[model samples]
Target: MKHCLVVDDSRVIRKVACRILGDLRFETDEAEDGAAALEICRRQMPDLILLDWNLPTMNGIEFLRALRREHEGKSPVVVFCTTENDVAHITEALGAGASEYIMKPFDREIIESKLAEVGML
Candidate 1:
């Protein structure tokens, strides 16, 4: 089974995403912050990462940059699941090596669609 990491400060969000990913046939892991997520990635990279924008210890963008630098181009596909809907934020995230973007308050369909866009679903 494919592995997916769900990084979010909100427990509810993590649980929801994990459930959705599980239904999509992915084995899921949860991290409450970017630092923890990075540590998990360092140990074993997941096939995909559903990341949140706001996090403690390290933010999503910072973690993305660090992950990209540390893993080169072999890093797992990262999809930013954030509330930031501005064009600039989206462009910044995409330019920072994110595979895709998913706006906040997402549901199963939206998550599935994003994953499919990234060829994960």
Candidate 2:
């Protein structure tokens, strides 16, 4: 099964995402912040990352930049799942190497479609 890392500060969001991804047949991991997420990646990079924008430490953009600098970091498809829904935010995320972007309040259908769009489904 493919592995997925869900990085979000909110426990509820993480739980929801984990459940959805699990139903989608993905082996899942959770991280409460970007720093923690990065540590997880260092140990074992996941196939996909569901990242949040505002985190306790390192933040999403910082984590993405740092991850892209790491060996094999480019291999995992980073998908920004956040409340930041602006053209500039989207542009920056895309430029920073995110494969896709998802706004806040997402459901299984949205996640499924995004996964399919990124060829993860």
Candidate 3:
């Protein structure tokens, strides 16, 4: 199964994403902040990343930038799942190496479609 890392500061969001990814047959892991997520990546880079924008220690953009700078970072498909819905935010995320973007208040259907679009499903 493909491994997925859900990075969000909200415990609820992380739990929800993990559960959805799990149901989709992905091996799931989660981190409450970007720093923690980066640590996890250092140990094991996941096949996909479901990321949130605002986070403690390190924000999503910073994490994406840092992750892309790593040796194996470009291998993982980064998908920004966040409340930041501005065109600029989306542009920045995509420019920073995110493969896709999802707005907040997402459900299983949305997640499924987005994953499929990124060819992760």
- Steric collisions counted per model: 0, 0, 0
Query: What does candidate 3's lDDT look like per residue over 1-121, in tens digits?
Result: 9999999989899998999999999999999889999999999989999999999999999999999988544579999999999999999999899999999989999999999999997
In the range 1-121, model 2's lDDT, one tens digit per residue, is 9999999999999999999999999999999999999999999999999999999968999999999988444579999999999999999999999999999889999999999999999
Candidate 1 vs candidate 3: the TM-score winner is: 1
Model 2: CA > 4 A from native:
none
TM-score of each: 0.97, 0.97, 0.97
Model 1, span 47-119: residue lDDT tens: 9999999999999999999999898783699999999888999999999999899998888899989999999
Model 1: CA > 4 A from native: none
**Which is superior by lDDT, 1 or 3?**
3
Task: Give the TM-score (vs. native) of candidate 1.
Answer: 0.97
The full ranking of all candidates by lDDT, starting with the best, is: 2, 3, 1
Worst 10 residues of 3 by lDDT: 66-75
| Model 1 residue 36 distance off true place after TM-score fit, in angstroms | 0.4
Q: Which is the leading candidate under lDDT?
A: 2
Report the error of model 1 at residue 34, Å.
Answer: 0.8
Estimate the lDDT of model 3: 0.93
* Model 2: per-residue Cα lDDT at residue 108: 93
RMSD of each: 0.8, 1.0, 1.1
